[model samples]
Target: MNTEVIWTFLSTQGADFALKVLGALAAWVVGRWLIGIVVALIGRALEAGKRVDATLIQYLKSIISVLLTLVLVLAILDIFGVHTTSFAALFAGAGLAIGAAWSGMLGNFAAGVFLQVLRPYKVGDFISAAGVTGTVKELGLFATTIVTPDNVLTVVGNNKVIADTIQNYSAEPYRRVDCVAKVANSVDAQDAIARLRPAIAAIPNVRTTPAPDIEILQFTPEGPLLCVRPYTHTDHYWQVYFDTHKAIVATFGAAGYPVPETPVAHRMVAAG
Candidate 1:
């Protein structure tokens, strides 16, 4: 209301509070920058070793970031005149409550640790876990990041991933690419198999050691369904899959094979 009162307020309470706020802001900015640098340095150091697992490096980065961020928060609280000791005591006292409230998160964290030790799947590996099939992008403190075949980024809880079955396509040196081909009922099954065997083997990246498998899987009303499976590295699965289908089409078309169509039966009911 008056200049003297305003000056008194500004000199005492207002100035101290404003200074604390600014100091807290400055600490937050600097702390975050330092945390980023530390995490980056750690990542580079681990990667430079060439023996360290990329998944483990990512997990370590996540943990270090969390711990540093927590420290930064405490420092900011101290800047505002909150005693760090008292705050830490309060946190310790509330540990049980926090654990109970965040049980799922804690479970995920524990699962992540087990995953690191067990090494079921690693970053860049294509795997199917917890119903998510994709290439593992990163294994974090509480979640596994997967980039799906369709380019979707999916995050799955580590707990769920560990609890469920995991199928790692890249674990083996080569994986089978399953493709099917249908020939007309009149077409010779053996001849179709003969044509496909060499054509599929000619595809780039297809393994010759095991050889491509071309066999009649089953019989449908249209024709005999041939299972055309090619073995290749998981990295070339899609290429071999698409090429197998194209080979079947070109080979059949060049051989003048008729298209297999589902035969529809027509019955006439007698009038009552």
Candidate 2:
């Protein structure tokens, strides 16, 4: 081919390539802005629902925006005569490998959705699950945040928690607290029970409607084993339990009840 002819062809092709590049860039910018507007509208709709968490809504909106933008980019590439089928196949192959590697993560994501839908637990609720007890801080797509009684932050996988039994202490408005107290076998069981009722009732946050009760659980070799059952508001259960225990000990001591002790035989007479 002649040099002049080659140069003329190259110039025309360069101008065409530049036009396509500009068009693709313009399409991408417009597409992104459109996606943003749609996502904002979706967020507003979710907010209007007033039943969903605002943070969750915003997260969903961002996810949707990214997906929409991806689709627009693929469309723009196709408009520029770029083949995307090969890209789709590559993505599918990669997705399969990723799915296998992240099977546990997928389970957690599914469990998180189940938890949200079922509403098994909520923020600020004290729950024991997967062998850990703490107050719920936040429920996320893969993990749940819990704050321990000592104020330590614990991140638990949602799948593990869902797989295990969940004990929600604050599920109900009231809770029953059981405490054990030992008294001397010489002390009258009936008298001990009577003393517990009045002492427990005097503690603040101890519910009187259901009434507290003390039962002789067993007769140990050392002394009588008593169990006290008191009902209190869920929030006050721990407070009442501690206070009632203190009150019972004080009342028993003041009343001169013999403290329970293990028996020790000082001497054994031998049979001759």
Candidate 3:
């Protein structure tokens, strides 16, 4: 009689355990499908809004999915008679510890959010930040990736970018190309202006509305300094800058005009 009772008890316990296992499996499958549906709905809402950055939307969707999956996991654990309240409290404590330990990562994430909202610069914008200059390639939750003009790829922490000044070269419609030329005192100012002005004005991307400004700026120890200021649309700033110098060198060489030995410092800015 005792043996029969033991067998019956064992069968009941086994069946209960099997039911729990099946329930957990069902919850996992259904929960995962629901999470997918939720994520898709969120994506649709963000797409319709059109106010959020593309990269930020992707990051937010991933976070939402992770959070939902975590909740689903906890529910499944509860089916196994696990202590969920204590587990959640323990999870919160552990999260706090991790957050304190990885505070820099948290800061980067915050900065990334701020950057996305502020719209200081966007992907494909050439910018200088965090002591580096490059074209923005991607914006992530923790880091921003940029590709240098020379093709060097740099990954910078978003926190670092927030701490520095951001110079956006591509934000404006026009950029100024500042060229200084130290010509020999013997060169006639009018002649030099006449020669350089038209050459700069004739460049393909140089803006003609304001026209190119060429005049004698100041005299230094080297010789007479002529400022060759030209306005060009932002995209052609660099090319026009280098090409103008090349043309200057060629023009002076052909005219037998002397250039001073002193190096000229170039200062560029948004065109005035």
Candidate 4:
């Protein structure tokens, strides 16, 4: 090739390459800035809508921003003469492989989606599932986080939670606490219940409207077993249970009522 021809070709190609690079860079920068602005606007709008949870709104906005940014990046690459079709195909293949490898996780993800949509439980609510009772700390894409009464953090798989029966204690504003007290067979069950009524009602957090009830459950060899059922505010269940128990014991003791003791039965074999 002649020197003049080579120089002319190099000059033309170099300018074109520089312009393309600049255009790609500019597109990326602009796209990133636009995504940021949109995300910020979404967050503000969600905050203004007090009906929705702010944390959930923020997470949704973040996801949208990420997806939009990815699309913009691919578009910029395509504009710079990069073949994106093969890249997209590769991405799809990888996604399929991952899905196959983690089928259980995909199921959990689906369950999580259902849970979010149905709004069965929210953060800070008390729920019982899979024999574990705790306050919900977070709801994630694949698991639900809970903090137990002992301050232990538990992570429950979304799929397992969905598949199992769930008991939401915080769903209602009030709850009833049921307690069983065993009195001596000699003690009058009805009198024992009457004595407990005043004290149970006086306990803090115990509801007055429903009125507590005491029933003689069964007659054991030791004494009469009684059941005490009291209605209380949901938040005061534990407090009422413990307080009522102590009050019942003290009241029975002060009344001079004899508490039945468990008697041991001894079988005597006659000498043969």
Q: Every model's Cα RMSD, please?
A: 9.7, 4.9, 7.6, 4.9
Off by over 4 Å in 2: 1-51, 72-84, 100-110, 263-272
- Model 4, range 1-272, lDDT digits (tens) per residue? 69988788778787887788899999989999999999998878767855445556766797899889878988988877999999889889998999999999989978886787677898888899877799999988789999998999999999999999999989987788988888876777888888888978888888887888778888787788888888987678889999989988888889998867666551122222
Steric overlap count per candidate: 0, 0, 0, 2
Error of 4 at 240 (Å): 0.9
Question: Which residue segments of model 1 deviate by more than 4 Å?
Answer: 1-93, 264-272
Better of 2 and 3 by lDDT: 3
Output the better candidate (2/4) by TM-score.
2
Q: Over the stretch 1-272, how does candidate 2's per-residue lDDT look in tens digits?
A: 59888788778787887788898999988988888889989888877866556667776887898779778878888977989998788878988999999999989988986776577889989899998898999988789999988899999999999999999999988888999888887898889889788888888988887888779988887688999988998788778889978988898988899988766641222221
Flag the better candidate by TM-score, 2 or 3. 2
- Which of candidates 1 and 2 is the stronger one according to lDDT? 1
- Model 3 clashes, total count: 0
Give me the displacement of residue 222 in model 2, in angstroms.
2.7
> Comparing candidate 1 with candidate 4, which one achieves the higher lDDT?
1
> Candidate 2, residue 89: CA error in Å?
1.3
lDDT tens digits by residue: candidate 3, 1-272: 99998788778787888899999999999999999999999988987877668778888899999999999999999998998999899989999999999999999999998887677888888899999898999987789999988999999999999999999998988878898776876778778778887778888889987887788899865568888888887778789999888877877787789766543442222232
Model 3: weakest 10-residue lDDT segment is 263-272
lDDT of each structure?
Answer: 0.91, 0.85, 0.85, 0.84
Of 2 and 4, which scores higher on lDDT? 2
User: Candidate 1: lDDT over CA atoms?
Assistant: 0.91
